[model samples]
Target: MTITIIGTGFVGVVSSAVFASFGNVVYGLDVDEVKVRSLSEGKVPFFEPELEELVGKSLSKGNLRFTTSYEEAVSQSEIVIIAVGTPSAADGTADLKYVKAATESLAPYLQEKTIVAIKSTVPPGTNRQVEEIISKHTDKEVSVVSLPEFLREGVAVSDTLHADRVVIGATQEWAIEKLLDLHEPLDGERVVMRPESAQMSKYAANAYLAMRITFINQIADLCEKTGADILEVIDGIGFDKRIGRHYWYPGLGYGGSCFPKDVKELAAVSKKLGDENNILVLMDHINEARIPVKLNDFGEKIGGWEGKQVSVLGLSFKPNTTDMREAPSLKVIPYLQEKNAIIKAYDPKAMDEAKKVWPSLFYANDVNEALDQAEVVIVLVEWDEFANLDLGRMKDGGWLIDTRQMYDKKSVESQQLQYLGIGTV
Candidate 1:
């Protein structure tokens, strides 16, 4: 099937590539002319390992294409996937301006019997609202489907290839059937649920993961006070088949492109609906507070960082990607800077993007460069290169704080460095 993916953001670009690679002729549309042009030239705008190669290969094979013309792209495909951005608004509700705009633009072009799938993470009932809006503009019967993509950063291509389950919600039976047929390449159980249920599934999945991370982070705090290893405790409980071991890491809390924003939006939406006492609200509060764990640790080691040079290793949240939308490292970096600490940071991929937000801070080229001439080294994101760095040779008497537990003490001792990992001495 020919798939037209609207909005070449992270989800759209990755989804389009995956869809096209597997025999589907995919055309991805974006309003940004530069992005579209770059994508056409097989230039990936953001950093995703092997994404450039995948996009280049798909483009060369004539399976995947990109364009700025929404109408042209939508008219050429049998399935239209709305993968646009639904960023959180200031008021805590999802700002659907982009989704709405995309729907309006594609309505006129959606004349044929097409399956319109909302792949973007949106608020509940957004798929229905989009269908109603599009129906009003076009006399044609459009099959709007809520087919949310649950792709995570760093490994989105793999996630798409091996999805645990695919959720299909549509206005008509044919829409769900068409989506299931299209997703035949995906290895997972296909669930034919209602549109609203499908929409909420994405949010619920992310929110629940946030709750798990927060729960573990709170437990990590308890472990710290009791002088117990959170990792060992996690391992003991993780063996239980009922509790499965994933996203149960007790560390510097969850932060990245999706979880933080999605959790906050859900909490805000619940509060607006007078469900202020919701447990999700507590989860959000806990997740938000988790951002300060490293800062508190930093203060404990070296009371005030006034006039101190602090080195922050790893800027990208959770590594393997350059996306730093809501990375906790961003919060901690600036927080230390405000306290009169000169910041020197290094990341495998996020330096360029991080420079935009923190241009004044010193950007180091490598892990050792970041550690050179620093009083404290804060491990924000656990990049593989950082995990095996020669810490002993890198720093002398510097406070080595590992927020992610990315290293073992013996490894740090081998490098002649003092190690301080979360929930570890």
Candidate 2:
């Protein structure tokens, strides 16, 4: 089936490439001409595991194309998917301005029997909101469906291609049937439900994950106080078949695009409905207040930050992606900076994006360069490159703080570096 996806950012472009790669004529539409042209020329705007290769293959097969015009995309495809960003507004409600704009632009182009699907993470009832907008604008009886995305940035291709489950949310029987058939190429379990329930499920998943991260982070602090290791603690509880072990590792906090926004929006939505479940608000509280356990350990030994040279490793929220939105490093770096500490930071891919936030912030070419002239080093993210570093060349004090616990402290000490890992011995 032919599909047109609007707003080719992280979600739009990846979904387009993956769909086109497998077997589909996908038109990627965006307002940014530069972005469309760049994608048209096989230039991916951001990094993902195998997205560029997939896009290239799809483009070569003539299964994928990009454009800036809504008419061009909507006219050529049988289904139009709103894959635009629903970034958080000031009050934590999802700003649907982009989704609204995309829907408005698509109104005139929507023909009779055209299926309009929303593939973005939005608040509940958004499908109806969009459907009403289309109803007011066009006479065509468009079938709107909510197929909220469950994509993780680093491994989006695999997530889309091998999704555990695909939720088909629509009142129209025909729309649900077609969406199931559309996703039949991928072998995800088909879960058909109402649009509102599917939308809430997306938020629920993110909220639960956020709670788990915040829950373990609190435990990590208690571990230090009780002379216990958080790693061993996780090991003891993780093997329980019922509990399982995913998103179980404690860290600085949950960040990037999804969890922060979704959890906040869910809390906001729930508050408006009634505060029966205040867990969402608490999850946000704990995550935002969650401090790096290793940072505190380092602070004990390395005292004040006045005129101290601090090296910050990993700027992105997590590894393999350049997204720094709501990254913990944003909080940590500023805390150090405010203490009059001279900071130098480095990341494999996030340097350019990080520079946008702190343009004058000192950056190094590599880990070695980042460690150059540093007295204390803080690992905010767990990239593989940092884990495989030659620690022997580190600062003379041997002060290394590992927030992700990505390195072995026993081996780190052999390199004449003092290792301070979160909840590790």
Candidate 3:
């Protein structure tokens, strides 16, 4: 299968590499000359585990290439996958200008019976809109299929190759069969559905996960007030197979490239459809308020935030990725700054990206450097290195505000430090 993936962003690059590694010839197309050139040289623009290696191997195998020209990439392809970013518009709807542009650009170059798979996360009727856009530009029989991606940023390569499910949303039998055959090597369940359902599936999945996080965070708040431990409560509820234990993490709320944007879009969609009162809207509101609320609580526990040397551990949203899109650190760092706290931040891989968003803040060379002479420490993202931090490096009687609940309270106390975790008595 010869494939052309439009967009050189996270999803496009990963899809290109994975598909090419499966023996499909893939061309990664992007408008940015520098990014296309970088990718052609086997360089990934962002930090994702094992992605550069996979791209390098696929390039070496002569099955993967990168280009700036749509004609060069899309003309000879059997499947054109649009994995462009559908960033949130001002009205909270998905901005589909990129999707529409990609469809228009590729329409003229699409071969007869080509499968145009949309791997970008979009609203329910977006596939139909893209199909209409394609119809306006070309007369060729191109089948637009809603092939929504479920790749988590940090482990995108693994997720692409071994996804939990591969959805093929198309009306044409031939289009469905061709897409299924293209994804035959991947180890995931095949879900065949309508385009709208496929699009909604991606939104619904993210919204449900966001709601779960919101639910847990709300419970954590209650636990803190009632002197109940959230960990024990989670353990107690996890035994019931219906509720499940996974994704019940109590933290500074859910923040990433997908959840925040998807939830907002879903809420906007619901509001536009006359469903003004919905959980989606409330979930987003609570998630947005989590950082400030938690920070205030931490401030009260630590005797206020003024004139303190605060060491912030972890900057990225979660871990193993340098992406800071909608990360909790975005909210956490600024709030501390406004409170007149001297900030010393450190992350394993996100310092560079974090510096871009927060250049005024002091970035530590390492964790030890960040902890040096620190009066208070705040754990934002749950990176692996933070799991076993040496609490003794901080000032004695300093506060450890564990927003991610990464550190044990007893362990911090052993080091003569006051430990504060979410949902813990």
Candidate 4:
């Protein structure tokens, strides 16, 4: 299969590499010339585990390439995948300007009977809108299929190659068969559905995951007030076959590239469709308030936030990636700054990215540097290195605010240090 993937972002690059590694010829197309050039040199713009190696290997095999010209990439491709970013607008709707533009640009160069698959996270009717946009520009018979992606950052390469399900949403039989054939090398259950259902599946999956995180956080809050341990409660219920134990961590709520924006988009769409009291709206509201609320409670626990020397570990939303979209550290750091707390922050992979957002922040060289002389130490992201941090490096009586529940309370207490964890009593 010869494939052209538009947008050299996270999804596009990963897809291109994975597909090409499986012997498919892939061309990664992007309007950003600098990014296209970087990718052409086998350099990934952001941090995703094992992505660079995969891209390098695919390039070496001469199966993967990157380019800025649609005519160069799209004209010779059998499947043109639109993997562009659909960022959120003010009203929480997916802004599809990029998807529309890509469709328009590729339409003129699309070969007859070519399949245009959409891998962007978008609203239900977005595939139809893209189909209409392409129709206006070309008379060629191009089938637009809703091929929503479910790749999680930090493990996108693995996810793409071993997805749980590959959805092919198209009315045309030939289009569906062509997409299935293209994805035949991947490991996943093939699901054929309407375009709208496929689009909604992406939003629904993210929203459900977001809801689970919010539900656990809400339970954690209740546990804290009632002197109950959230870990024990989770264990008690998680053992049930009906309720699995995955994604049940009680933390500073859910934050990443997908969950927050997807929930907001769903809530906005539901409200506009007359379901004003949707639970998704409440879930998003609570998540938005989670960091500040937890921070205030922690401040009260450790005397006050004023004049406190705070050390923060981890800056990315989660581990194994440098993406900081809606990360809890984004809220945690700024809130501490406003409260006049002197701060030193450290992360293995995200410090450089974090520095872009907060240049004046005192970024430590390592864990020891950040923890040294700190009055309060907070673990925002659960990176592997933070799991066994030396508590004795901090001030003897300093507080350890474990938002991710990464440490045992007794262990910190043994070091003559105070420990504060969510939903722990």
Among all windows of 10 consecutive residues in model 2, the one with the lowest summed lDDT is 289-298
Across residues 249-358, which tens digit of lDDT does each residue of candidate 3 receive?
A: 89889999999999999999999999988999899888888889889988998889999999999998879999999988888888998999999999999988988887
Q: How far in Å is the alpha carbon of 68 misplaced in model 1? A: 0.9
Candidate No. with top lDDT: 4
My TM-score estimates for the predictions, one after another, are 0.96, 0.96, 0.98, 0.99
> Which segments of candidate 3 are over 4 A away from where they belong?
none
The per-prediction CA RMSD against the true structure, in angstroms, equals 1.6, 1.7, 0.9, 0.9
What are the lDDT figures for the candidates, one per model? 0.83, 0.85, 0.90, 0.91
User: Compared to the true structure, candidate 4 yields what TM-score?
Assistant: 0.99
| lDDT of candidate model 3 versus the reference | 0.90
The sequence of per-residue lDDT tens digits that candidate 4 reaches over residues 1-425 is: 89999998989999999989889999999999999999989889899999999999989989999999999999999999999988899998888899999988999899999999999998988877987988888889988889999999988989988999998888999998888888899999999999999999999999999998899989999999999999999988999989977879789999999999999999999999999888999998999988888999999999999999999999999999999999989999889999999999999999889989999899999999898989999999889999888777899899999988888999899998999999987
Clashes of 3: 0
Tens-place lDDT per residue, model 2, 198-312, is: 8888888888888888888888878877888998888888899887766686778889989999998988887887894698878887777666444555676677667888889
Off by over 4 Å in 4: none
TM-score (C-alpha) between model 3 and the true structure: 0.98
The CA lDDT at 206 in model 3 is 95
Model 1, 274-303: lDDT tens digits are: 999898888877777666655766586766
